[model samples]
Target: MQACANWIDGGPQPSRADQWLDVTNPATGAVIARVPLSTAEEVEQAVQSAERAFADWGCWPPVERARVMFRFQQVLRDHFDELARLIVEDNGKTLAEAKGSVQRGIEVVEFAAGIPSLGMGDVLKDIAPGVDCEMIRQPLGVVAGFTPFNFPVMVPLWMIPIALACGNTFVLKPSERAPLAGLRIAELFAECGAPPGTWNVLHGTARVAEQLMADPRIQAVSVVGSSPIA
Candidate 1:
Protein backbone atom coordinates (compact mmCIF):
# COMPACT_ATOMS: atom_id res chain seq x y z
CA MET A 1 0.00 0.00 0.00
CA GLN A 2 1.13 3.58 -0.61
CA ALA A 3 2.12 5.70 2.35
CA CYS A 4 1.30 9.40 2.37
CA ALA A 5 3.90 11.79 3.66
CA ASN A 6 3.45 15.18 5.20
CA TRP A 7 4.13 18.27 3.10
CA ILE A 8 6.30 20.34 5.35
CA ASP A 9 8.44 23.33 4.49
CA GLY A 10 8.22 23.01 0.70
CA GLY A 11 8.30 19.26 0.14
CA PRO A 12 7.28 15.83 1.37
CA GLN A 13 8.88 14.12 4.34
CA PRO A 14 8.02 10.81 5.95
CA SER A 15 6.84 11.24 9.49
CA ARG A 16 8.92 9.90 12.37
CA ALA A 17 5.77 8.58 13.92
CA ASP A 18 5.44 4.94 14.92
CA GLN A 19 1.76 4.75 14.09
CA TRP A 20 -0.54 5.61 11.21
CA LEU A 21 -4.14 5.56 10.07
CA ASP A 22 -5.37 3.80 6.97
CA VAL A 23 -6.98 5.76 4.14
CA THR A 24 -9.59 3.52 2.61
CA ASN A 25 -11.55 4.03 -0.55
CA PRO A 26 -15.01 4.64 0.80
CA ALA A 27 -16.67 3.18 -2.29
CA THR A 28 -14.91 -0.12 -1.67
CA GLY A 29 -13.31 -1.66 1.42
CA ALA A 30 -9.81 -1.36 0.02
CA VAL A 31 -7.08 0.44 1.91
CA ILE A 32 -5.56 2.85 -0.55
CA ALA A 33 -2.91 4.40 1.65
CA ARG A 34 -1.61 5.05 5.14
CA VAL A 35 -1.26 8.49 6.68
CA PRO A 36 0.99 9.02 9.62
CA LEU A 37 -0.35 9.76 13.04
CA SER A 38 2.25 12.47 13.10
CA THR A 39 4.12 13.10 16.31
CA ALA A 40 3.78 16.33 18.23
CA GLU A 41 7.31 17.24 17.19
CA GLU A 42 6.29 16.99 13.56
CA VAL A 43 3.29 19.21 14.27
CA GLU A 44 5.64 21.72 15.88
CA GLN A 45 7.86 21.59 12.83
CA ALA A 46 4.92 22.51 10.60
CA VAL A 47 4.00 25.45 12.80
CA GLN A 48 7.61 26.65 12.89
CA SER A 49 7.90 26.39 9.13
CA ALA A 50 4.81 28.55 8.68
CA GLU A 51 6.14 31.04 11.21
CA ARG A 52 9.42 31.37 9.34
CA ALA A 53 7.71 31.85 6.02
CA PHE A 54 5.32 34.42 7.48
CA ALA A 55 8.20 36.89 7.96
CA ASP A 56 8.59 37.35 4.23
CA TRP A 57 5.11 36.33 3.08
CA GLY A 58 3.37 38.82 5.36
CA CYS A 59 5.55 41.60 3.98
CA TRP A 60 4.72 40.78 0.34
CA PRO A 61 2.49 43.31 -1.36
CA PRO A 62 -1.11 42.19 -1.70
CA VAL A 63 -0.81 42.35 -5.48
CA GLU A 64 2.11 39.97 -5.45
CA ARG A 65 0.23 37.60 -3.19
CA ALA A 66 -2.77 37.83 -5.49
CA ARG A 67 -0.56 36.94 -8.40
CA VAL A 68 0.36 33.68 -6.71
CA MET A 69 -3.33 32.94 -6.21
CA PHE A 70 -3.90 33.58 -9.89
CA ARG A 71 -1.27 31.00 -10.76
CA PHE A 72 -2.73 28.53 -8.26
CA GLN A 73 -6.18 28.94 -9.75
CA GLN A 74 -4.78 28.14 -13.17
CA VAL A 75 -2.93 25.13 -11.85
CA LEU A 76 -6.09 23.84 -10.22
CA ARG A 77 -7.86 24.27 -13.52
CA ASP A 78 -5.23 22.31 -15.36
CA HIS A 79 -5.71 19.36 -13.05
CA PHE A 80 -9.43 19.67 -12.53
CA ASP A 81 -10.35 16.21 -13.74
CA GLU A 82 -7.61 14.48 -11.77
CA LEU A 83 -8.61 16.28 -8.56
CA ALA A 84 -12.22 15.27 -8.99
CA ARG A 85 -11.22 11.68 -9.45
CA LEU A 86 -9.06 11.78 -6.36
CA ILE A 87 -11.86 13.32 -4.37
CA VAL A 88 -14.22 10.56 -5.47
CA GLU A 89 -11.74 7.91 -4.46
CA ASP A 90 -11.02 9.48 -1.13
CA ASN A 91 -14.48 10.60 -0.13
CA GLY A 92 -16.70 8.17 -2.06
CA LYS A 93 -18.69 11.04 -3.47
CA THR A 94 -20.20 10.64 -6.92
CA LEU A 95 -18.00 11.87 -9.77
CA ALA A 96 -20.34 14.81 -10.41
CA GLU A 97 -20.35 15.77 -6.75
CA ALA A 98 -16.58 15.58 -6.61
CA LYS A 99 -16.33 17.79 -9.67
CA GLY A 100 -18.71 20.26 -8.11
CA SER A 101 -16.64 20.39 -4.97
CA VAL A 102 -13.45 20.99 -6.91
CA GLN A 103 -15.16 23.65 -8.98
CA ARG A 104 -16.33 25.48 -5.89
CA GLY A 105 -12.79 25.31 -4.54
CA ILE A 106 -11.50 26.85 -7.77
CA GLU A 107 -14.05 29.61 -7.40
CA VAL A 108 -12.68 30.40 -3.99
CA VAL A 109 -9.25 30.59 -5.53
CA GLU A 110 -10.64 33.04 -8.08
CA PHE A 111 -11.96 35.17 -5.26
CA ALA A 112 -8.63 35.01 -3.51
CA ALA A 113 -6.93 36.16 -6.71
CA GLY A 114 -8.77 39.45 -6.28
CA ILE A 115 -7.37 40.08 -2.83
CA PRO A 116 -5.32 42.99 -4.07
CA SER A 117 -8.54 44.92 -4.32
CA LEU A 118 -10.67 43.02 -1.83
CA GLY A 119 -8.15 43.28 0.99
CA MET A 120 -7.49 46.96 0.61
CA GLY A 121 -7.80 49.08 3.73
CA ASP A 122 -9.83 52.25 3.97
CA VAL A 123 -8.89 55.74 4.89
CA LEU A 124 -11.25 58.40 6.24
CA LYS A 125 -9.53 61.58 5.27
CA ASP A 126 -10.31 64.85 7.09
CA ILE A 127 -12.99 63.27 9.23
CA ALA A 128 -12.42 66.02 11.80
CA PRO A 129 -10.71 69.40 11.39
CA GLY A 130 -7.23 68.58 10.11
CA VAL A 131 -7.60 65.02 11.43
CA ASP A 132 -7.70 61.78 9.49
CA CYS A 133 -8.27 58.14 10.37
CA GLU A 134 -7.15 55.07 8.49
CA MET A 135 -7.74 51.33 8.79
CA ILE A 136 -5.03 49.00 7.48
CA ARG A 137 -5.33 45.27 7.12
CA GLN A 138 -2.41 42.97 7.89
CA PRO A 139 -1.65 39.27 8.00
CA LEU A 140 -1.52 37.42 11.25
CA GLY A 141 1.70 35.47 11.84
CA VAL A 142 0.70 31.85 11.23
CA VAL A 143 -2.68 30.20 10.96
CA ALA A 144 -3.83 26.57 11.02
CA GLY A 145 -6.90 24.87 9.62
CA PHE A 146 -8.56 21.59 10.55
CA THR A 147 -10.90 20.24 7.91
CA PRO A 148 -13.49 17.51 8.09
CA PHE A 149 -13.68 14.42 5.88
CA ASN A 150 -16.91 15.38 4.14
CA PHE A 151 -15.53 18.33 2.17
CA PRO A 152 -11.85 17.44 1.99
CA VAL A 153 -10.92 19.59 -0.96
CA MET A 154 -13.38 22.47 -0.67
CA VAL A 155 -12.95 23.06 3.04
CA PRO A 156 -9.19 23.37 2.84
CA LEU A 157 -9.57 25.64 -0.17
CA TRP A 158 -11.89 27.89 1.83
CA MET A 159 -9.17 28.47 4.41
CA ILE A 160 -5.88 28.35 2.44
CA PRO A 161 -6.50 30.80 -0.39
CA ILE A 162 -7.84 33.59 1.80
CA ALA A 163 -5.12 33.19 4.43
CA LEU A 164 -2.35 33.17 1.82
CA ALA A 165 -3.92 35.92 -0.26
CA CYS A 166 -4.04 38.04 2.87
CA GLY A 167 -0.28 37.31 3.23
CA ASN A 168 -0.35 34.83 6.12
CA THR A 169 1.38 31.45 6.00
CA PHE A 170 -0.66 28.31 6.71
CA VAL A 171 -0.50 24.79 8.11
CA LEU A 172 -3.40 22.44 7.36
CA LYS A 173 -4.47 19.15 8.97
CA PRO A 174 -6.84 17.36 6.67
CA SER A 175 -9.14 14.64 7.99
CA GLU A 176 -7.45 11.30 8.44
CA ARG A 177 -10.38 9.60 6.72
CA ALA A 178 -9.68 11.39 3.42
CA PRO A 179 -6.31 13.07 3.06
CA LEU A 180 -5.27 12.51 -0.53
CA ALA A 181 -7.26 15.41 -1.96
CA GLY A 182 -5.72 17.80 0.50
CA LEU A 183 -2.25 16.37 -0.09
CA ARG A 184 -2.64 16.78 -3.83
CA ILE A 185 -3.78 20.35 -3.37
CA ALA A 186 -0.64 21.09 -1.38
CA GLU A 187 1.50 19.54 -4.11
CA LEU A 188 -0.20 21.60 -6.83
CA PHE A 189 0.21 24.77 -4.80
CA ALA A 190 3.95 24.07 -4.53
CA GLU A 191 4.14 23.42 -8.28
CA CYS A 192 2.49 26.80 -8.90
CA GLY A 193 5.65 28.42 -7.47
CA ALA A 194 4.38 29.24 -4.03
CA PRO A 195 7.34 29.68 -1.71
CA PRO A 196 8.15 26.98 0.84
CA GLY A 197 6.15 27.12 4.07
CA THR A 198 3.52 29.41 2.56
CA TRP A 199 1.19 26.39 2.66
CA ASN A 200 1.71 22.97 4.20
CA VAL A 201 -0.22 19.76 4.86
CA LEU A 202 0.14 17.57 7.91
CA HIS A 203 -1.83 14.33 7.90
CA GLY A 204 -2.81 12.93 11.26
CA THR A 205 -5.66 12.34 13.70
CA ALA A 206 -7.32 14.50 16.34
CA ARG A 207 -4.26 14.40 18.54
CA VAL A 208 -2.34 16.30 15.90
CA ALA A 209 -5.09 18.86 15.65
CA GLU A 210 -4.95 19.36 19.41
CA GLN A 211 -1.21 19.89 19.23
CA LEU A 212 -1.61 22.52 16.56
CA MET A 213 -4.30 24.31 18.52
CA ALA A 214 -2.24 24.36 21.69
CA ASP A 215 0.85 25.78 20.07
CA PRO A 216 1.57 29.44 20.74
CA ARG A 217 2.98 29.89 17.25
CA ILE A 218 -0.43 29.32 15.70
CA GLN A 219 -2.01 32.80 15.69
CA ALA A 220 -5.41 31.50 14.63
CA VAL A 221 -7.14 28.20 13.98
CA SER A 222 -10.19 27.38 11.87
CA VAL A 223 -11.93 24.08 12.33
CA VAL A 224 -15.00 22.50 10.73
CA GLY A 225 -16.92 19.82 12.61
CA SER A 226 -19.90 19.11 14.83
CA SER A 227 -20.29 20.95 18.14
CA PRO A 228 -18.75 18.11 20.15
CA ILE A 229 -15.68 18.08 17.93
CA ALA A 230 -15.61 21.84 17.61
Candidate 2:
Protein backbone atom coordinates (compact mmCIF):
# COMPACT_ATOMS: atom_id res chain seq x y z
CA MET A 1 0.00 0.00 0.00
CA GLN A 2 1.11 3.54 -0.69
CA ALA A 3 1.82 5.59 2.42
CA CYS A 4 1.24 9.35 2.76
CA ALA A 5 2.94 11.68 5.19
CA ASN A 6 2.35 15.29 6.28
CA TRP A 7 3.47 18.45 4.41
CA ILE A 8 5.32 20.84 6.63
CA ASP A 9 7.41 23.94 5.91
CA GLY A 10 6.82 23.61 2.13
CA GLY A 11 7.84 19.92 1.87
CA PRO A 12 6.80 16.44 2.92
CA GLN A 13 8.20 15.34 6.24
CA PRO A 14 8.07 11.72 7.32
CA SER A 15 6.06 11.43 10.48
CA ARG A 16 7.69 10.65 13.76
CA ALA A 17 4.42 9.05 14.83
CA ASP A 18 4.35 5.39 15.71
CA GLN A 19 0.74 4.95 14.52
CA TRP A 20 -1.11 5.20 11.21
CA LEU A 21 -4.66 5.34 9.89
CA ASP A 22 -5.95 3.37 6.92
CA VAL A 23 -7.62 5.24 4.06
CA THR A 24 -10.30 3.12 2.42
CA ASN A 25 -12.14 3.38 -0.87
CA PRO A 26 -15.70 3.92 0.32
CA ALA A 27 -17.25 2.38 -2.77
CA THR A 28 -15.12 -0.77 -2.93
CA GLY A 29 -14.36 -1.14 0.77
CA ALA A 30 -10.72 -1.64 -0.01
CA VAL A 31 -7.83 -0.08 1.86
CA ILE A 32 -5.94 2.21 -0.49
CA ALA A 33 -3.34 3.87 1.68
CA ARG A 34 -2.18 4.61 5.22
CA VAL A 35 -1.77 8.11 6.69
CA PRO A 36 0.10 9.07 9.77
CA LEU A 37 -1.75 9.56 13.02
CA SER A 38 0.40 12.49 14.05
CA THR A 39 1.44 13.04 17.62
CA ALA A 40 0.77 16.33 19.45
CA GLU A 41 4.46 17.11 19.20
CA GLU A 42 4.35 16.68 15.44
CA VAL A 43 1.25 18.85 15.02
CA GLU A 44 2.84 21.50 17.21
CA GLN A 45 5.84 21.57 14.94
CA ALA A 46 3.68 22.67 12.02
CA VAL A 47 2.06 25.30 14.21
CA GLN A 48 5.47 26.60 15.19
CA SER A 49 6.47 26.86 11.55
CA ALA A 50 3.36 28.91 10.78
CA GLU A 51 4.05 31.12 13.79
CA ARG A 52 7.57 31.76 12.61
CA ALA A 53 6.45 32.55 9.07
CA PHE A 54 3.66 34.86 10.24
CA ALA A 55 5.94 37.74 11.17
CA ASP A 56 6.99 38.22 7.57
CA TRP A 57 3.98 36.85 5.68
CA GLY A 58 1.43 38.70 7.77
CA CYS A 59 3.26 41.95 7.10
CA TRP A 60 3.45 41.59 3.34
CA PRO A 61 1.42 44.18 1.40
CA PRO A 62 -1.95 42.93 0.19
CA VAL A 63 -1.01 43.34 -3.49
CA GLU A 64 2.12 41.23 -3.06
CA ARG A 65 0.04 38.60 -1.30
CA ALA A 66 -2.49 38.71 -4.14
CA ARG A 67 0.33 38.04 -6.59
CA VAL A 68 0.94 34.71 -4.88
CA MET A 69 -2.77 33.88 -5.05
CA PHE A 70 -2.80 34.73 -8.76
CA ARG A 71 -0.05 32.21 -9.46
CA PHE A 72 -1.73 29.68 -7.17
CA GLN A 73 -4.99 30.00 -9.06
CA GLN A 74 -3.22 29.51 -12.37
CA VAL A 75 -1.37 26.46 -11.12
CA LEU A 76 -4.63 24.98 -9.85
CA ARG A 77 -6.27 25.64 -13.19
CA ASP A 78 -3.40 23.90 -14.95
CA HIS A 79 -3.94 20.79 -12.83
CA PHE A 80 -7.72 20.80 -12.76
CA ASP A 81 -8.21 17.33 -14.15
CA GLU A 82 -5.33 15.84 -12.21
CA LEU A 83 -6.66 17.20 -8.92
CA ALA A 84 -10.14 15.87 -9.62
CA ARG A 85 -8.71 12.44 -10.30
CA LEU A 86 -6.87 12.46 -6.98
CA ILE A 87 -10.10 13.36 -5.21
CA VAL A 88 -11.96 10.47 -6.84
CA GLU A 89 -9.17 8.01 -6.11
CA ASP A 90 -8.82 9.09 -2.53
CA ASN A 91 -12.47 9.55 -1.54
CA GLY A 92 -14.33 7.21 -3.88
CA LYS A 93 -16.42 10.04 -5.25
CA THR A 94 -17.66 9.86 -8.81
CA LEU A 95 -15.45 11.64 -11.32
CA ALA A 96 -18.12 14.26 -12.01
CA GLU A 97 -18.61 15.00 -8.35
CA ALA A 98 -14.89 15.18 -7.79
CA LYS A 99 -14.57 17.67 -10.62
CA GLY A 100 -17.32 19.79 -9.12
CA SER A 101 -15.56 19.72 -5.75
CA VAL A 102 -12.30 20.80 -7.32
CA GLN A 103 -14.04 23.51 -9.33
CA ARG A 104 -15.64 24.92 -6.21
CA GLY A 105 -12.20 25.17 -4.69
CA ILE A 106 -10.93 26.93 -7.78
CA GLU A 107 -13.63 29.55 -7.43
CA VAL A 108 -12.48 30.31 -3.91
CA VAL A 109 -8.96 30.79 -5.19
CA GLU A 110 -10.32 33.20 -7.78
CA PHE A 111 -12.07 35.20 -5.09
CA ALA A 112 -8.88 35.21 -3.05
CA ALA A 113 -6.96 36.54 -6.00
CA GLY A 114 -9.15 39.62 -5.92
CA ILE A 115 -8.60 40.25 -2.24
CA PRO A 116 -6.43 43.33 -2.86
CA SER A 117 -9.52 45.21 -3.99
CA LEU A 118 -12.39 43.27 -2.42
CA GLY A 119 -10.90 43.11 1.07
CA MET A 120 -9.81 46.70 1.37
CA GLY A 121 -10.64 48.67 4.50
CA ASP A 122 -12.51 51.97 4.94
CA VAL A 123 -11.77 55.33 6.44
CA LEU A 124 -14.04 58.23 7.50
CA LYS A 125 -11.91 61.31 7.53
CA ASP A 126 -12.82 64.23 9.80
CA ILE A 127 -16.01 62.54 10.90
CA ALA A 128 -16.12 64.58 14.09
CA PRO A 129 -14.03 67.75 14.20
CA GLY A 130 -10.74 66.68 12.63
CA VAL A 131 -10.89 63.11 13.89
CA ASP A 132 -10.57 60.09 11.61
CA CYS A 133 -10.66 56.34 11.97
CA GLU A 134 -9.80 53.46 9.70
CA MET A 135 -11.10 49.92 9.69
CA ILE A 136 -8.83 47.51 7.86
CA ARG A 137 -8.85 43.75 7.50
CA GLN A 138 -5.59 42.46 8.90
CA PRO A 139 -4.14 39.01 9.14
CA LEU A 140 -4.64 37.03 12.29
CA GLY A 141 -1.42 35.30 13.17
CA VAL A 142 -1.10 31.55 12.64
CA VAL A 143 -4.57 30.52 11.52
CA ALA A 144 -5.43 26.83 11.36
CA GLY A 145 -7.90 24.84 9.27
CA PHE A 146 -9.54 21.58 10.36
CA THR A 147 -11.28 19.96 7.38
CA PRO A 148 -13.38 16.82 7.06
CA PHE A 149 -13.08 13.91 4.66
CA ASN A 150 -16.28 14.26 2.65
CA PHE A 151 -15.44 17.61 1.01
CA PRO A 152 -11.71 17.28 1.15
CA VAL A 153 -10.93 19.73 -1.65
CA MET A 154 -13.77 22.18 -1.14
CA VAL A 155 -13.46 22.61 2.62
CA PRO A 156 -9.74 23.32 2.69
CA LEU A 157 -10.12 25.62 -0.29
CA TRP A 158 -12.73 27.65 1.58
CA MET A 159 -10.17 28.55 4.19
CA ILE A 160 -6.58 28.34 2.95
CA PRO A 161 -6.69 30.75 0.02
CA ILE A 162 -8.53 33.52 1.82
CA ALA A 163 -6.28 33.15 4.83
CA LEU A 164 -3.13 33.33 2.74
CA ALA A 165 -4.43 36.15 0.57
CA CYS A 166 -5.19 38.21 3.62
CA GLY A 167 -1.60 37.73 4.77
CA ASN A 168 -2.08 35.01 7.39
CA THR A 169 0.10 31.92 7.58
CA PHE A 170 -1.91 28.69 7.87
CA VAL A 171 -1.62 25.22 9.32
CA LEU A 172 -3.97 22.59 7.89
CA LYS A 173 -5.00 19.38 9.64
CA PRO A 174 -6.85 17.50 6.94
CA SER A 175 -8.91 14.41 7.81
CA GLU A 176 -6.80 11.29 7.93
CA ARG A 177 -9.43 9.31 6.02
CA ALA A 178 -8.67 11.26 2.77
CA PRO A 179 -5.30 12.86 3.13
CA LEU A 180 -3.98 12.61 -0.42
CA ALA A 181 -5.88 15.55 -1.93
CA GLY A 182 -4.59 17.95 0.70
CA LEU A 183 -1.02 16.80 0.21
CA ARG A 184 -1.34 17.21 -3.55
CA ILE A 185 -2.86 20.69 -3.25
CA ALA A 186 -0.10 21.76 -0.89
CA GLU A 187 2.37 20.72 -3.55
CA LEU A 188 0.63 23.02 -6.03
CA PHE A 189 0.76 25.91 -3.54
CA ALA A 190 4.51 25.41 -3.22
CA GLU A 191 4.91 25.27 -7.00
CA CYS A 192 3.20 28.67 -7.22
CA GLY A 193 5.87 30.31 -5.04
CA ALA A 194 4.26 30.31 -1.61
CA PRO A 195 7.06 30.67 0.90
CA PRO A 196 8.09 27.83 3.18
CA GLY A 197 6.29 27.73 6.53
CA THR A 198 3.58 30.08 5.15
CA TRP A 199 1.36 27.05 4.62
CA ASN A 200 1.64 23.60 6.23
CA VAL A 201 -0.34 20.35 6.52
CA LEU A 202 -0.56 17.69 9.20
CA HIS A 203 -2.67 14.51 9.00
CA GLY A 204 -4.26 12.98 12.05
CA THR A 205 -7.52 12.35 13.94
CA ALA A 206 -9.45 14.22 16.64
CA ARG A 207 -6.54 14.17 19.05
CA VAL A 208 -4.55 16.43 16.79
CA ALA A 209 -7.59 18.63 16.17
CA GLU A 210 -8.11 19.13 19.86
CA GLN A 211 -4.47 20.02 20.32
CA LEU A 212 -4.80 22.69 17.61
CA MET A 213 -7.90 24.15 19.24
CA ALA A 214 -6.20 24.38 22.62
CA ASP A 215 -3.02 25.94 21.34
CA PRO A 216 -2.59 29.64 22.07
CA ARG A 217 -0.62 30.40 18.93
CA ILE A 218 -3.51 29.50 16.62
CA GLN A 219 -5.27 32.87 16.53
CA ALA A 220 -8.14 31.61 14.39
CA VAL A 221 -9.60 28.18 13.61
CA SER A 222 -11.99 27.13 10.85
CA VAL A 223 -13.84 23.82 10.91
CA VAL A 224 -16.17 22.46 8.21
CA GLY A 225 -16.92 19.05 9.52
CA SER A 226 -19.53 17.25 11.62
CA SER A 227 -21.04 18.81 14.71
CA PRO A 228 -18.94 16.56 16.91
CA ILE A 229 -15.79 17.43 15.05
CA ALA A 230 -16.64 21.11 15.13
RMSD of each: 1.1, 1.3
Residue-wise C-alpha lDDT for candidate 2, range 103-210, written one tens digit per residue: 999999989999889889999999899899999888889989889888888899999999899889999988888888988898889987667899999888888888
lDDT of 2 at 128: 95
Cα deviation in Å at residue 192, candidate 2?
A: 1.3
Counted clashes in each candidate structure = 0, 0
The 10-residue segment of model 2 with minimum total lDDT is 221-230
Expressed as tens digits, the lDDT of each residue in 106-224 for candidate 1 is 99999999998899899999999999999999888899999999998999999999999998999998888899999999999998766799898898877888888888888899999
Model 1 lDDT-worst window of ten: 221-230
Q: What TM-score goes with each of the models?
A: 0.97, 0.96
State in Å the error of residue 58, model 1.
1.0
